[model samples]
Target chain A: AQSVAQPEDQVNVAEGNPLTVKCTYSVSGNPYLFWYVQYPNRGLQFLLKYITGDNLVKGSYGFEAEFNKSQTSFHLKKPSALVSDSALYFCAVRDTDRGSTLGRLYFGRGTQLTVWP
Target chain B: DTAVSQTPKYLVTQMGNDKSIKCEQNLGHDTMYWYKQDSKKFLKIMFSYNNKELIINETVPNRFSPKSPDKAHLNLHINSLELGDSAVYFCASSQDRGQGANVLTFGAGSRLTVL
Candidate 1:
Protein backbone atom coordinates (compact mmCIF):
# COMPACT_ATOMS: atom_id res chain seq x y z
CA ALA A 1 0.00 0.00 0.00
CA GLN A 2 1.14 3.53 -0.72
CA SER A 3 0.86 6.07 2.07
CA VAL A 4 2.15 9.39 3.37
CA ALA A 5 2.99 10.38 6.92
CA GLN A 6 3.36 13.83 8.41
CA PRO A 7 5.28 13.35 11.62
CA GLU A 8 4.14 16.60 13.23
CA ASP A 9 0.57 17.50 13.98
CA GLN A 10 1.45 21.14 14.49
CA VAL A 11 4.50 23.29 13.86
CA ASN A 12 5.09 26.69 15.46
CA VAL A 13 7.49 29.30 14.26
CA ALA A 14 8.18 33.01 14.68
CA GLU A 15 7.85 35.46 11.88
CA GLY A 16 10.92 35.71 9.65
CA ASN A 17 12.22 32.41 11.00
CA PRO A 18 12.85 29.38 8.92
CA LEU A 19 10.22 26.67 8.95
CA THR A 20 10.04 23.05 7.99
CA VAL A 21 7.25 20.51 7.82
CA LYS A 22 8.44 16.92 7.79
CA CYS A 23 6.92 14.24 5.58
CA THR A 24 7.85 10.62 4.92
CA TYR A 25 6.28 8.00 2.74
CA SER A 26 6.18 4.28 2.05
CA VAL A 27 5.44 3.01 -1.43
CA SER A 28 6.17 0.07 -3.66
CA GLY A 29 7.67 1.98 -6.58
CA ASN A 30 9.22 5.33 -7.36
CA PRO A 31 7.21 8.16 -5.71
CA TYR A 32 5.81 11.37 -7.09
CA LEU A 33 5.60 13.61 -4.06
CA PHE A 34 3.47 16.74 -3.71
CA TRP A 35 2.61 19.45 -1.19
CA TYR A 36 -0.70 21.27 -0.72
CA VAL A 37 -1.98 23.95 1.61
CA GLN A 38 -5.45 24.39 3.05
CA TYR A 39 -6.55 27.58 4.69
CA PRO A 40 -9.37 27.75 7.19
CA ASN A 41 -12.68 26.95 5.48
CA ARG A 42 -11.00 26.76 2.07
CA GLY A 43 -9.99 24.02 -0.30
CA LEU A 44 -6.49 22.78 -0.83
CA GLN A 45 -4.10 24.71 -3.03
CA PHE A 46 -1.28 22.96 -4.81
CA LEU A 47 2.14 24.01 -3.55
CA LEU A 48 4.71 21.93 -5.35
CA LYS A 49 5.48 18.48 -6.67
CA TYR A 50 8.58 16.36 -7.18
CA ILE A 51 8.64 14.45 -10.41
CA THR A 52 12.02 13.29 -11.80
CA GLY A 53 14.18 16.34 -11.61
CA ASP A 54 16.39 18.10 -9.12
CA ASN A 55 16.11 17.18 -5.51
CA LEU A 56 14.90 20.69 -4.63
CA VAL A 57 11.71 21.90 -6.33
CA LYS A 58 10.44 25.45 -5.86
CA GLY A 59 6.78 26.33 -5.87
CA SER A 60 4.26 29.05 -5.22
CA TYR A 61 4.46 31.58 -2.38
CA GLY A 62 8.22 31.12 -1.92
CA PHE A 63 7.80 27.55 -0.76
CA GLU A 64 10.16 24.76 -1.73
CA ALA A 65 10.42 21.05 -1.05
CA GLU A 66 13.34 18.65 -1.14
CA PHE A 67 12.79 15.10 -2.24
CA ASN A 68 15.07 12.56 -0.62
CA LYS A 69 14.75 9.29 -2.43
CA SER A 70 17.02 7.47 -0.03
CA GLN A 71 15.01 8.47 3.00
CA THR A 72 11.69 8.27 1.18
CA SER A 73 10.84 11.77 2.29
CA PHE A 74 9.78 15.10 0.83
CA HIS A 75 10.11 17.88 3.38
CA LEU A 76 8.61 21.33 2.75
CA LYS A 77 10.73 24.30 3.72
CA LYS A 78 10.65 28.06 3.66
CA PRO A 79 13.42 30.50 4.45
CA SER A 80 11.17 33.01 6.19
CA ALA A 81 7.85 32.39 7.79
CA LEU A 82 4.95 34.81 7.76
CA VAL A 83 1.79 34.88 9.79
CA SER A 84 -0.24 34.56 6.62
CA ASP A 85 1.74 31.46 5.74
CA SER A 86 0.28 29.67 8.72
CA ALA A 87 -2.24 27.06 7.62
CA LEU A 88 -2.75 23.35 7.23
CA TYR A 89 -0.12 21.60 5.16
CA PHE A 90 -0.45 18.20 3.56
CA CYS A 91 2.02 15.91 1.91
CA ALA A 92 0.89 13.44 -0.70
CA VAL A 93 2.52 10.70 -2.76
CA ARG A 94 1.70 8.70 -5.89
CA ASP A 95 3.35 5.70 -7.45
CA THR A 96 5.38 6.23 -10.62
CA ASP A 97 5.80 2.69 -11.83
CA ARG A 98 5.14 2.00 -15.46
CA GLY A 99 2.92 -0.88 -14.42
CA SER A 100 1.17 1.12 -11.78
CA THR A 101 -2.55 1.35 -12.38
CA LEU A 102 -3.62 3.42 -9.36
CA GLY A 103 -2.96 7.02 -10.29
CA ARG A 104 -4.66 8.57 -7.29
CA LEU A 105 -2.66 10.44 -4.68
CA TYR A 106 -2.53 9.37 -1.04
CA PHE A 107 -2.62 12.35 1.28
CA GLY A 108 -1.11 12.78 4.70
CA ARG A 109 -2.99 13.64 7.86
CA GLY A 110 -1.90 17.28 7.58
CA THR A 111 0.24 19.53 9.78
CA GLN A 112 -1.01 22.80 11.21
CA LEU A 113 1.51 25.61 11.07
CA THR A 114 1.14 28.56 13.39
CA VAL A 115 3.47 31.44 12.78
CA TRP A 116 3.53 33.92 15.66
CA PRO A 117 3.87 37.57 14.96
CA ASP B 1 -12.59 33.48 -13.44
CA THR B 2 -12.72 30.47 -11.17
CA ALA B 3 -11.05 27.58 -12.87
CA VAL B 4 -12.98 25.08 -10.81
CA SER B 5 -16.32 25.63 -9.02
CA GLN B 6 -18.56 23.58 -6.74
CA THR B 7 -22.18 24.40 -5.96
CA PRO B 8 -23.75 24.56 -2.48
CA LYS B 9 -20.68 25.94 -0.76
CA TYR B 10 -22.45 24.96 2.40
CA LEU B 11 -24.96 22.15 2.74
CA VAL B 12 -26.79 21.31 5.95
CA THR B 13 -29.12 18.35 5.91
CA GLN B 14 -30.54 15.76 8.26
CA MET B 15 -29.25 12.24 8.48
CA GLY B 16 -30.79 9.61 6.21
CA ASN B 17 -31.48 12.25 3.65
CA ASP B 18 -29.91 12.34 0.21
CA LYS B 19 -28.05 15.20 -1.45
CA SER B 20 -25.87 15.91 -4.42
CA ILE B 21 -22.89 18.17 -4.92
CA LYS B 22 -22.15 19.61 -8.33
CA CYS B 23 -18.77 20.44 -9.83
CA GLU B 24 -17.67 22.12 -13.01
CA GLN B 25 -14.33 23.17 -14.40
CA ASN B 26 -13.55 25.59 -17.19
CA LEU B 27 -9.91 24.73 -17.69
CA GLY B 28 -10.85 22.30 -20.45
CA HIS B 29 -9.22 19.51 -18.47
CA ASP B 30 -10.20 15.94 -19.22
CA THR B 31 -9.83 14.58 -15.69
CA MET B 32 -11.82 15.48 -12.58
CA TYR B 33 -11.81 14.20 -9.01
CA TRP B 34 -13.87 14.25 -5.84
CA TYR B 35 -12.15 14.14 -2.47
CA LYS B 36 -13.50 13.93 1.05
CA GLN B 37 -11.84 15.71 3.93
CA ASP B 38 -12.71 14.10 7.21
CA SER B 39 -13.00 15.77 10.59
CA LYS B 40 -9.38 15.09 11.30
CA LYS B 41 -8.61 16.96 8.07
CA PHE B 42 -7.40 13.98 6.11
CA LEU B 43 -8.20 14.29 2.43
CA LYS B 44 -9.03 11.04 0.65
CA ILE B 45 -9.80 10.39 -2.96
CA MET B 46 -13.28 8.99 -3.45
CA PHE B 47 -13.62 8.91 -7.24
CA SER B 48 -11.76 10.00 -10.31
CA TYR B 49 -13.07 10.40 -13.85
CA ASN B 50 -10.87 10.95 -16.85
CA ASN B 51 -12.59 11.88 -20.06
CA LYS B 52 -15.89 10.45 -18.74
CA GLU B 53 -14.31 7.14 -17.75
CA LEU B 54 -13.84 5.99 -14.18
CA ILE B 55 -10.16 5.62 -13.43
CA ILE B 56 -9.75 5.54 -9.67
CA ASN B 57 -12.30 4.34 -7.16
CA GLU B 58 -11.02 3.88 -3.61
CA THR B 59 -13.37 1.45 -1.99
CA VAL B 60 -15.94 4.15 -1.35
CA PRO B 61 -19.38 3.08 -0.16
CA ASN B 62 -21.93 2.42 -2.86
CA ARG B 63 -24.15 5.02 -1.24
CA PHE B 64 -21.86 7.63 -2.70
CA SER B 65 -22.01 7.78 -6.50
CA PRO B 66 -20.22 10.11 -8.85
CA LYS B 67 -21.72 11.36 -12.10
CA SER B 68 -19.68 12.88 -14.87
CA PRO B 69 -21.92 14.41 -17.50
CA ASP B 70 -18.94 15.53 -19.53
CA LYS B 71 -15.21 15.93 -19.33
CA ALA B 72 -15.63 19.17 -17.37
CA HIS B 73 -18.31 18.29 -14.84
CA LEU B 74 -18.25 15.64 -12.10
CA ASN B 75 -20.98 15.59 -9.46
CA LEU B 76 -21.12 13.54 -6.27
CA HIS B 77 -24.35 12.07 -5.01
CA ILE B 78 -24.70 10.62 -1.53
CA ASN B 79 -27.65 8.49 -0.62
CA SER B 80 -28.91 7.96 2.94
CA LEU B 81 -26.36 10.31 4.36
CA GLU B 82 -24.83 9.57 7.72
CA LEU B 83 -23.47 11.85 10.40
CA GLY B 84 -19.99 10.54 9.74
CA ASP B 85 -20.30 11.87 6.22
CA SER B 86 -20.24 15.45 7.42
CA ALA B 87 -17.06 17.04 6.21
CA VAL B 88 -15.59 19.24 3.52
CA TYR B 89 -15.81 17.88 0.00
CA PHE B 90 -13.57 19.23 -2.68
CA CYS B 91 -13.66 18.97 -6.47
CA ALA B 92 -10.51 19.19 -8.50
CA SER B 93 -9.35 18.82 -12.08
CA SER B 94 -6.14 18.37 -13.98
CA GLN B 95 -5.05 18.58 -17.56
CA ASP B 96 -4.06 14.92 -17.54
CA ARG B 97 -2.93 12.14 -15.29
CA GLY B 98 0.57 10.77 -15.28
CA GLN B 99 3.74 10.81 -13.21
CA GLY B 100 1.94 13.27 -10.85
CA ALA B 101 3.34 16.25 -12.66
CA ASN B 102 -0.02 17.71 -13.57
CA VAL B 103 -1.05 20.54 -11.27
CA LEU B 104 -4.59 20.15 -10.00
CA THR B 105 -7.03 23.08 -10.01
CA PHE B 106 -9.32 22.95 -7.01
CA GLY B 107 -12.59 24.66 -6.15
CA ALA B 108 -13.29 26.62 -2.99
CA GLY B 109 -14.94 23.43 -1.59
CA SER B 110 -18.33 22.50 -0.17
CA ARG B 111 -18.92 21.90 3.51
CA LEU B 112 -21.47 19.13 4.04
CA THR B 113 -23.06 18.84 7.45
CA VAL B 114 -25.37 15.98 8.41
CA LEU B 115 -27.50 16.55 11.42
Candidate 2:
Protein backbone atom coordinates (compact mmCIF):
# COMPACT_ATOMS: atom_id res chain seq x y z
CA ALA A 1 0.00 0.00 0.00
CA GLN A 2 1.18 3.51 -0.82
CA SER A 3 0.69 6.43 1.56
CA VAL A 4 1.71 10.05 2.13
CA ALA A 5 2.27 11.87 5.41
CA GLN A 6 2.27 15.62 6.00
CA PRO A 7 3.76 16.04 9.44
CA GLU A 8 2.55 19.57 9.94
CA ASP A 9 -1.11 20.42 10.29
CA GLN A 10 -0.57 24.18 10.00
CA VAL A 11 2.45 26.26 9.09
CA ASN A 12 2.62 30.01 9.77
CA VAL A 13 5.16 32.21 8.09
CA ALA A 14 5.70 35.88 7.50
CA GLU A 15 5.32 37.36 4.05
CA GLY A 16 8.45 37.85 1.92
CA ASN A 17 10.16 35.24 4.09
CA PRO A 18 11.04 31.67 3.26
CA LEU A 19 8.55 28.87 3.83
CA THR A 20 8.77 25.11 4.01
CA VAL A 21 6.05 22.44 4.08
CA LYS A 22 7.25 18.91 4.77
CA CYS A 23 5.98 15.75 3.10
CA THR A 24 6.99 12.09 3.28
CA TYR A 25 5.86 9.00 1.41
CA SER A 26 5.92 5.23 1.49
CA VAL A 27 5.47 3.14 -1.64
CA SER A 28 5.97 -0.44 -2.75
CA GLY A 29 7.69 0.46 -6.00
CA ASN A 30 8.94 3.66 -7.61
CA PRO A 31 6.99 6.63 -6.34
CA TYR A 32 5.26 9.34 -8.36
CA LEU A 33 5.01 12.26 -5.97
CA PHE A 34 2.84 15.35 -6.39
CA TRP A 35 1.97 18.58 -4.62
CA TYR A 36 -1.36 20.38 -4.82
CA VAL A 37 -2.72 23.63 -3.35
CA GLN A 38 -6.34 24.46 -2.59
CA TYR A 39 -7.83 27.78 -1.62
CA PRO A 40 -11.00 28.23 0.36
CA ASN A 41 -14.11 27.07 -1.49
CA ARG A 42 -12.04 25.91 -4.47
CA GLY A 43 -10.71 22.66 -5.82
CA LEU A 44 -7.12 21.64 -5.58
CA GLN A 45 -4.65 22.92 -8.20
CA PHE A 46 -1.60 21.03 -9.26
CA LEU A 47 1.68 22.50 -8.20
CA LEU A 48 4.43 20.10 -9.22
CA LYS A 49 5.33 16.44 -9.62
CA TYR A 50 8.42 14.24 -9.45
CA ILE A 51 8.57 11.13 -11.62
CA THR A 52 12.14 10.24 -12.35
CA GLY A 53 14.40 13.19 -12.89
CA ASP A 54 16.49 15.64 -10.92
CA ASN A 55 15.99 15.74 -7.20
CA LEU A 56 14.93 19.37 -7.28
CA VAL A 57 11.64 20.09 -9.09
CA LYS A 58 10.25 23.58 -9.68
CA GLY A 59 6.53 24.25 -9.82
CA SER A 60 3.95 26.98 -10.25
CA TYR A 61 3.82 30.19 -8.19
CA GLY A 62 7.54 30.22 -7.55
CA PHE A 63 7.42 27.03 -5.51
CA GLU A 64 9.93 24.18 -5.58
CA ALA A 65 10.26 20.74 -3.98
CA GLU A 66 13.25 18.57 -3.32
CA PHE A 67 12.91 14.81 -3.79
CA ASN A 68 15.19 13.07 -1.36
CA LYS A 69 15.10 9.33 -1.96
CA SER A 70 17.22 8.36 0.97
CA GLN A 71 15.12 10.31 3.38
CA THR A 72 11.88 9.26 1.68
CA SER A 73 10.77 12.87 1.67
CA PHE A 74 9.63 15.53 -0.78
CA HIS A 75 9.43 18.88 0.97
CA LEU A 76 7.90 21.95 -0.73
CA LYS A 77 9.80 25.20 -0.38
CA LYS A 78 9.71 28.80 -1.49
CA PRO A 79 12.36 31.44 -1.18
CA SER A 80 9.79 34.19 -0.63
CA ALA A 81 6.24 33.76 0.51
CA LEU A 82 3.25 35.94 -0.24
CA VAL A 83 0.01 36.53 1.68
CA SER A 84 -1.95 34.99 -1.18
CA ASP A 85 0.06 31.83 -0.78
CA SER A 86 -1.99 30.91 2.26
CA ALA A 87 -3.93 27.77 1.37
CA LEU A 88 -4.35 24.06 2.05
CA TYR A 89 -1.59 21.89 0.64
CA PHE A 90 -1.70 18.19 -0.04
CA CYS A 91 0.95 15.60 -0.81
CA ALA A 92 0.10 12.60 -2.91
CA VAL A 93 1.86 9.45 -4.14
CA ARG A 94 1.24 6.71 -6.68
CA ASP A 95 2.94 3.39 -7.23
CA THR A 96 4.48 2.70 -10.65
CA ASP A 97 3.97 -1.03 -10.46
CA ARG A 98 0.89 -1.74 -12.55
CA GLY A 99 -1.18 -4.64 -11.37
CA SER A 100 -4.41 -3.98 -9.53
CA THR A 101 -4.26 -0.37 -8.45
CA LEU A 102 -2.56 1.91 -10.96
CA GLY A 103 -2.70 5.67 -11.27
CA ARG A 104 -4.55 6.03 -7.98
CA LEU A 105 -3.19 8.80 -5.81
CA TYR A 106 -2.99 8.28 -2.04
CA PHE A 107 -3.17 11.71 -0.48
CA GLY A 108 -2.09 12.88 2.92
CA ARG A 109 -4.34 14.51 5.48
CA GLY A 110 -3.29 18.06 4.31
CA THR A 111 -1.36 21.02 5.60
CA GLN A 112 -2.83 24.48 6.05
CA LEU A 113 -0.30 27.17 5.16
CA THR A 114 -0.83 30.70 6.43
CA VAL A 115 1.47 33.41 5.16
CA TRP A 116 0.94 36.60 7.17
CA PRO A 117 2.05 40.04 6.12
CA ASP B 1 -13.85 27.88 -20.22
CA THR B 2 -13.49 25.43 -17.40
CA ALA B 3 -11.67 22.21 -18.16
CA VAL B 4 -13.65 20.26 -15.58
CA SER B 5 -16.99 21.38 -14.23
CA GLN B 6 -19.63 20.06 -11.82
CA THR B 7 -23.21 21.17 -11.40
CA PRO B 8 -25.01 22.21 -8.17
CA LYS B 9 -22.25 24.22 -6.56
CA TYR B 10 -24.16 24.16 -3.29
CA LEU B 11 -26.76 21.69 -2.06
CA VAL B 12 -28.78 21.65 1.16
CA THR B 13 -31.45 19.11 1.95
CA GLN B 14 -32.98 16.97 4.66
CA MET B 15 -31.53 13.69 5.81
CA GLY B 16 -33.95 11.51 3.86
CA ASN B 17 -33.78 13.47 0.66
CA ASP B 18 -31.79 12.24 -2.32
CA LYS B 19 -29.58 14.37 -4.55
CA SER B 20 -27.37 14.06 -7.58
CA ILE B 21 -24.22 15.87 -8.60
CA LYS B 22 -23.21 16.07 -12.24
CA CYS B 23 -19.68 16.35 -13.56
CA GLU B 24 -18.21 16.85 -17.01
CA GLN B 25 -14.73 17.26 -18.38
CA ASN B 26 -13.87 18.88 -21.71
CA LEU B 27 -10.16 18.13 -21.76
CA GLY B 28 -10.72 15.04 -23.92
CA HIS B 29 -9.37 12.86 -21.16
CA ASP B 30 -10.15 9.16 -20.80
CA THR B 31 -10.37 8.95 -17.00
CA MET B 32 -12.77 10.61 -14.56
CA TYR B 33 -12.84 10.40 -10.79
CA TRP B 34 -15.07 11.36 -7.87
CA TYR B 35 -13.61 12.53 -4.61
CA LYS B 36 -15.18 13.51 -1.30
CA GLN B 37 -13.80 16.18 1.00
CA ASP B 38 -14.98 15.90 4.56
CA SER B 39 -15.48 18.59 7.17
CA LYS B 40 -11.83 18.45 8.16
CA LYS B 41 -10.87 18.84 4.49
CA PHE B 42 -9.66 15.29 3.93
CA LEU B 43 -10.04 14.35 0.30
CA LYS B 44 -10.60 10.71 -0.60
CA ILE B 45 -11.34 8.98 -3.87
CA MET B 46 -14.67 7.22 -4.16
CA PHE B 47 -14.92 6.10 -7.75
CA SER B 48 -13.07 6.39 -11.06
CA TYR B 49 -14.27 5.72 -14.59
CA ASN B 50 -12.00 5.18 -17.56
CA ASN B 51 -13.55 5.53 -21.01
CA LYS B 52 -17.03 5.03 -19.57
CA GLU B 53 -15.96 1.91 -17.77
CA LEU B 54 -15.49 1.46 -14.06
CA ILE B 55 -11.79 1.47 -13.32
CA ILE B 56 -11.43 2.15 -9.59
CA ASN B 57 -14.16 1.82 -6.96
CA GLU B 58 -13.07 2.40 -3.42
CA THR B 59 -14.78 1.12 -0.27
CA VAL B 60 -17.71 3.47 -0.45
CA PRO B 61 -21.23 3.06 0.83
CA ASN B 62 -23.89 1.30 -1.26
CA ARG B 63 -26.08 4.41 -1.05
CA PHE B 64 -23.63 6.20 -3.29
CA SER B 65 -23.63 5.25 -6.97
CA PRO B 66 -21.66 6.79 -9.82
CA LYS B 67 -22.89 6.73 -13.39
CA SER B 68 -20.81 7.46 -16.46
CA PRO B 69 -23.06 7.97 -19.42
CA ASP B 70 -20.12 8.69 -21.72
CA LYS B 71 -16.43 9.35 -21.69
CA ALA B 72 -16.80 13.00 -20.85
CA HIS B 73 -19.54 12.79 -18.23
CA LEU B 74 -19.69 11.20 -14.78
CA ASN B 75 -22.47 11.81 -12.34
CA LEU B 76 -22.91 10.73 -8.73
CA HIS B 77 -26.30 9.95 -7.22
CA ILE B 78 -26.94 9.34 -3.59
CA ASN B 79 -29.94 7.17 -2.79
CA SER B 80 -30.60 8.15 0.85
CA LEU B 81 -28.80 11.14 2.13
CA GLU B 82 -27.46 10.98 5.66
CA LEU B 83 -25.87 13.58 7.86
CA GLY B 84 -22.52 11.85 7.47
CA ASP B 85 -22.73 12.40 3.72
CA SER B 86 -22.29 16.13 4.10
CA ALA B 87 -19.09 17.18 2.39
CA VAL B 88 -17.63 18.79 -0.70
CA TYR B 89 -17.57 16.47 -3.69
CA PHE B 90 -15.02 16.99 -6.46
CA CYS B 91 -14.70 15.62 -9.96
CA ALA B 92 -11.31 15.05 -11.50
CA SER B 93 -9.83 13.72 -14.73
CA SER B 94 -6.58 12.59 -16.26
CA GLN B 95 -5.37 11.72 -19.74
CA ASP B 96 -4.86 8.03 -18.98
CA ARG B 97 -4.23 5.83 -15.97
CA GLY B 98 -1.46 3.76 -17.54
CA GLN B 99 1.33 6.33 -17.33
CA GLY B 100 3.36 7.42 -14.35
CA ALA B 101 2.98 11.16 -14.79
CA ASN B 102 -0.82 11.22 -14.94
CA VAL B 103 -1.81 14.40 -13.12
CA LEU B 104 -5.45 14.87 -12.22
CA THR B 105 -7.31 18.06 -13.09
CA PHE B 106 -10.15 18.73 -10.65
CA GLY B 107 -13.41 20.65 -10.86
CA ALA B 108 -14.50 23.51 -8.64
CA GLY B 109 -16.40 21.05 -6.37
CA SER B 110 -19.97 20.86 -5.02
CA ARG B 111 -20.72 21.38 -1.36
CA LEU B 112 -23.41 19.09 0.11
CA THR B 113 -25.02 19.75 3.45
CA VAL B 114 -27.44 17.17 4.86
CA LEU B 115 -29.55 18.30 7.78
Measured by TM-score, the strongest candidate is: 2
Candidate 1 residue runs with Cα over 4 Å from true position: A98-102, B97-101
The candidates' interface RMSDs, in order, read 2.4, 2.1
lDDT of 2 by residue, B14-106 (tens): 998889999999989888999999999999999999889998899999899999999999999998899999999999998864552378999
lDDT of 1 by residue, A1-117 (tens): 889999999999999999999999998888888899999988889999987779999999999999998988899999999999999999988765555433778899999999999
Top model by DockQ, which number?
A: 1
lDDT per model vs. reference: 0.91, 0.93
Writing each residue's lDDT as its tens digit, candidate 1 over B21-78 gives 9999998888899999988988888999988999889889999999998998999999
Model 1 CA lDDT for position A79: 99
lDDT of 1: 0.91
Clashing pairs in 1: none
Q: Best-fitting candidate, measured by lDDT?
A: 2
Candidate 2: residue A60 lDDT (0-100) = 97
Model 2 chain B worst lDDT run, 10 consecutive residues: B94-103
